[model samples]
Target: MSDFFLNIVEDEPQALSPEKVWKVAVIDDEESVHQATKLALANTHIMGRKLEFLNAYSAKDGLALLSAHSDIAVVLLDVVMETPEAGLGLAKAIRHDLRNFHTQIILRTGQPGYAPEESVITDYEVNDYKTKSELTRTKLFSAVYTAVRAYQNLTSLAAGREGLRKIIDSASTLFQERSIAKFSEGALEQINALFNINSDGIFCVSSAPKNPSPELAQYLTQHKHVDLSEVDNDFRVIATSTGYRDLFGVPLQQIPKKEVRQLINRALTTKSHVIEDHHIALYLDTPSTWQACIYLHSQQDITDKVDHEILKVFASNIALGLENTKFLTQLADTAYKDDVTSCYNRNGLMERAIPEVIDSNDHAVLYLLDIDYFHEITEALGFEYGNRVLNSFADKLKDAFPSDAMIARMHSDVFAVIVPGHGQPPIKRLIEHCSNQPLILENGDALRLGVTIGLSIHQEGTQADTTPESLIRHAEVALNKSKEQRRGSATTYDESLDAGSLERLNLLSELRRALSSNELELYVQPQVDISQQCKVVGMEVLLRWHHPILGNISPGVFVPLAERSGLAYELDLYVLRHSCSLVRQHPDLPPVSINLSAMSLDRGELLDDFASIMERFHITTKQISLEVTEGCLIKGNSALTNLQRLSDAGWDIHLDDFGSGYSSLNYLLRLPISTVKIDRLFILELKKTQHAATLLTGIIGIILNIGKRVVVEGIETQDQNDFVANAGAEVVQGFLHYRPVPFLSFVDEYKSH
Candidate 1:
């Protein structure tokens, strides 16, 4: 040991080496203890740095000083002070309350009796515990030195955790609500941030699933030539004879593939991240697909031991974040999807289709489809089952068409599909597909559901105003014409269809005013219970609107228009309230059936409105039957919940048009409905089509099996009446039964009968 005196021959404080000074805080209750501790640790150099002593006389004062200087790194605490266990309390407070667990704590006690040896070491979350009397000058110095080194390790770990969190947050924000190009750019930026380095990166999704050795050889093209396929297990000098280090395409040799596969097999495994040499890999195991990220860097420092630990923590968080992002993306995509056919929805079409059409250099074909007589199915089986029928029909439409076709649900039982650069052959294939298959409902009933499709191709010389709305209108006109012919067939765009669609739009605008002006009227179609020898049971109300200028308008045209304009709710409510009032006015009338729109049911006010109307009219619940279609019931859980709510309100629930679209047998059990109406298509084709006969019989069997009553609609002939009666259908309604007439006309007809 050399005797040293204070020699202040030093450089300016600013010019002094930053590494030469270390600030040490000595905390003890006794002033003598602090002086003694400082004296013993004076002029000490553990790792080439001279110590400067800091003193705190009590635990309270020491904590205040510790908080002010978080970079102090190490704390020396005395166990006994004003309180017997002040040091332990301070340590607990720091670790839990102050969140300073990363800082090192060393406990020294002059009164050894106050601090138990084994308990203090184990129970308190301090770095070391010692008796101050036992701590020699050499031992004290050694303890302080050890504590500082440990704090450095903890600081590194904390920084790593924080860095990983920031990177994940940044990546997540970048990917959220982004386009494909932006997503690619964001991914590259994230990768650069992950490595803490600036580097150019490109991503390409290959047909091949696994990482190939050729990728590395391909990356180093400028350095050397190498054949990846020619060698196995043996290292071949590829790109660098220039002493450049090279690693395999995948990192994580420590986590052997066999071991990873075993870990994956053990349970529902999440993603894994691993590091090796100069690369970091991310592994994800999706059903039938294994996606991974293989990152490569030129510097060896990128995979240091400390960096490797940090990489592992980063990988775990990355896996979770990636999983969350992917799931969120899928969920967002589903929001813009049509559940039945898994096609784009109307919203999706409007967002994506118009832009695509605008960008097209070639002619694009737009085809709008309407399922002919779709109402008959929902009425026959109830909306719950009927929706399944529509879904089945939609599935057939999707399968029959090509994958590249941009298909969307434009409205209930209606679809608009866009085919870009579709020549005659592909369009013919689509037409053939539509012609080939009839949708099969869940009840094992086959619906030869006819589709009327309208096609419009934007020509090269046509005005560039081929917007999605215009294309949809063009296709719709063709569809209406095909429907008018009672044929489930395809029609290409003609100028006449465009003119007709424009007229239809004008008609819709006018129809909006019809409700307020009392232009709407109702006709009663008598529902005859044939089992009671053609006795009148209930009457179904049909809406008719006659424009003063346009003359008589079809419900088919105005009804859909009303639904689209968001006025269907008011129209439906008015009809129900008025219908109930009519029943009250004429005590001789039986229960009346009124068809409800899907949109009206979704409003959640239908039940309350119905209840109020019935209460006001002083009518019993048995006098009203609410008719709803199958398309309305199965849109989502909310729809099903609404149906349940309506059934609970005591109105007789009738499945308006059954045997039409997908009739979900499941809904019969879920819904509390009393009546199921057989569609008129089956009744109309009873004389000619064997397919129609089989479908009608199958639908009847399903209804009877579920204990629901059946009403066969569209009986226009004595033969049609005989056919429905022979099929064991309990009720029948049609023009032949008696054409729909006004209340006065109904009275006149009933009086004569």
Candidate 2:
């Protein structure tokens, strides 16, 4: 990574109160806003919690922070950055991509016109919408507090709901325990942890002897602590929150309070519960062999009637007791194992496999395998069938690896397995089996599976074995690399891949800087009207980067770089805005055509921005032309609609790179295009292949027949220029006629003309 990207790394946040701090993220492009927000919210508290601020100066930085800090309670978001909708885009990413629905997003904007409050609120789950100008320090503080409270309330409700669910599950499990003594203990613990209380609970179990002396009965009822040798003979405390360790396994009768003994006896005799102001003793409806009672205490009142009733009903049902151990195992399995496949899940992998790999003295290899086109399969077949297929896959995995080997379903169609030692993992064989072996579903539908595997090996005593997180991360990177190459391919982690990624990030950082600096410039190449003795007709605008160290960089290098870096929209807007300014300044210039990416058109916002730019520059649509390729047709309805819209608004639309594949004659006739620029490849290949010249001539003739003008691209020789002129091309753009010149030079030339 370059120093430019280093600027995004924020300083470590100072520790707030560990137990009672709401993490709030400030995501804005302005440094002043970050400082003001920090000052305004310095001492602000909401829901008995002080605020801890995490600042991100850009939408990209904000997203990275959100991903890292899942505990963020609220996001103070600005509505514009590189583009008008950058903040909105980040909000969508948070909800859909990050799967973070709980974080309250208070959308703040400097310019309200760019974002309509009603629509943005409806669309992006905005909690509170405010403009920067209206946000007085006091109002800002109040707004944050309100949103923070909403976040706290929402999370509390979620936690409470989850707690209730666990309580019900544990309560049901309590009744299913086979042993009467164990059953009482389970109920006592569940009641203490899950219900509306925060004090100790004790469960006592008793079994009457067939024949016993007075001394024996007295000794069983009240004596010493229970231990390994002691058996359940009479009533005894199974569990209690007695502070002294020595009192833990002692007899229930040893407690100083007379109510404790009386309460247990009353509940046992009545076969019900004895409730008091501070404590409740419930009788366990266990087997006839043994009797049990659970004594619980609450410092606070059981205000909720429903909770009280549920606890009583829960204590009343202990007669089931069938397969208790198995039921508990399944409940535990649901947490760590996949519900459908019954294999380990991601949590299971982390707990069980990560430690093994880090601790093992033997070499270990981790395989991250992905099933290709799994989503498509689910879409075509039903999700039920997809689950069945997953079950089949899990079974195969079990059969392939040893029982002790760690296998887990990381997520969706992705599975991971760590095979410790050089045991010959049989990974290749497993892939072969999946490919050749058809999975016969419950409905008799058979489908074959294809797998892609990414492997990361950890040699014992190597630095890689120190951290399982890096091992897993490397495997994920390898998986992405494998998929990028093609599906059903295998890849191993390599350091070069990381190097290449860092290089790309550096390039992206540089490009972002170039966009703002004067390092980027638009150049123009004149088009010729051959019939008018090769007179200059129009010009096509081109973007170039003049890097400080590496002068005159190619568009081929940076154009796709901008697209991949999520800066394509910004770059397109810059070109359109710059071209409009050029046309505005030089009133004598012909319609200056500029390229707009199909991606921008499909985004559905850039067209309006383009219109706004034109209106700002006082330039008519006729003064500037929008050029696109066949890629526009496939980018869906938005691109096609926008092309027609621009043409209808009196802007010229030229279909650039014609016959570069994907262009159809039917589409050509239907689309509202005035000019077709044949791809440069034909001109480059004219001398090499006679078929090229024939094809070029045929395409030009067909374009002219439709009443549309043709622009022959990439001509370098007089022969090629003359050849295109005779082939019905009205306008010719190439080095042979007029080489590209800087925008400033083009302006000077026009003025001189």
The numbered model that scores best in TM-score is 2
Taken over the whole model, the C-alpha lDDT of each candidate is 0.64, 0.72
Error of 2 at 8 (Å): 45
Instruction: Give candidate 1 misplaced runs (Cα > 4 Å).
Output: 1-498, 616-620, 689-702, 717-727, 751-753
Candidate 1 RMSD computed on C-alpha atoms after optimal superposition onto the true structure: 22.8
lDDT at 304 for candidate 2?
54
Clashes of 1: 23
lDDT of 1 by residue, 1-753 (tens): 000001111111123364755567777878888788888987776435677667787778877877777666667788788788888877777776678765667887876655555655545557677788868775576567655544543454434355555553464355353243344345545555765654432221111223333433453232223344432222111111122223222222322345332332222224454444554434433211213342333355455533554454544333333333333334345555776666788867767864586467467787787876666666556788767876776777667665666778877888877766754335556655665565677778776766677777776776645677766666776777777565667787677666776787788778767777767887899989888888998899988877888889888878877886688888897788778777887778767889988888777676777788788889877887889898877555555677788777677889877768767777677788788887787776777878888878788878888899888889888877877677778788998877888865786677687
Cα RMSD (angstroms) for every candidate in the order listed: 22.8, 17.7
Per-residue lDDT of model 2, residues 1-753, tens digit only: 000000000111124454778899999999999898888778775545678999998889999999999989889998887678889889889988998877889888897555554766666667777789867775576566546544543454333354445543564355444344465456566666666466567766553432333544454354322231344435666555553234456676686668777887788778777777777777664322345677777777654522654554455333222122222333344456776776779877776676766586467778898998786677556788789898888777777776767888999999998877787456668778767788776777788889998888887666654357777888887887788778878888888777866777788899989888746899999998888988888999999888888777789888977875678889988898788777777778877888988778667676688888888999888788888889877766656788778788788889999888797888778999888989899998888999988988998988899898888888889898889878877788888878889988977877786
Per-model TM-score versus the true fold: 0.39, 0.52
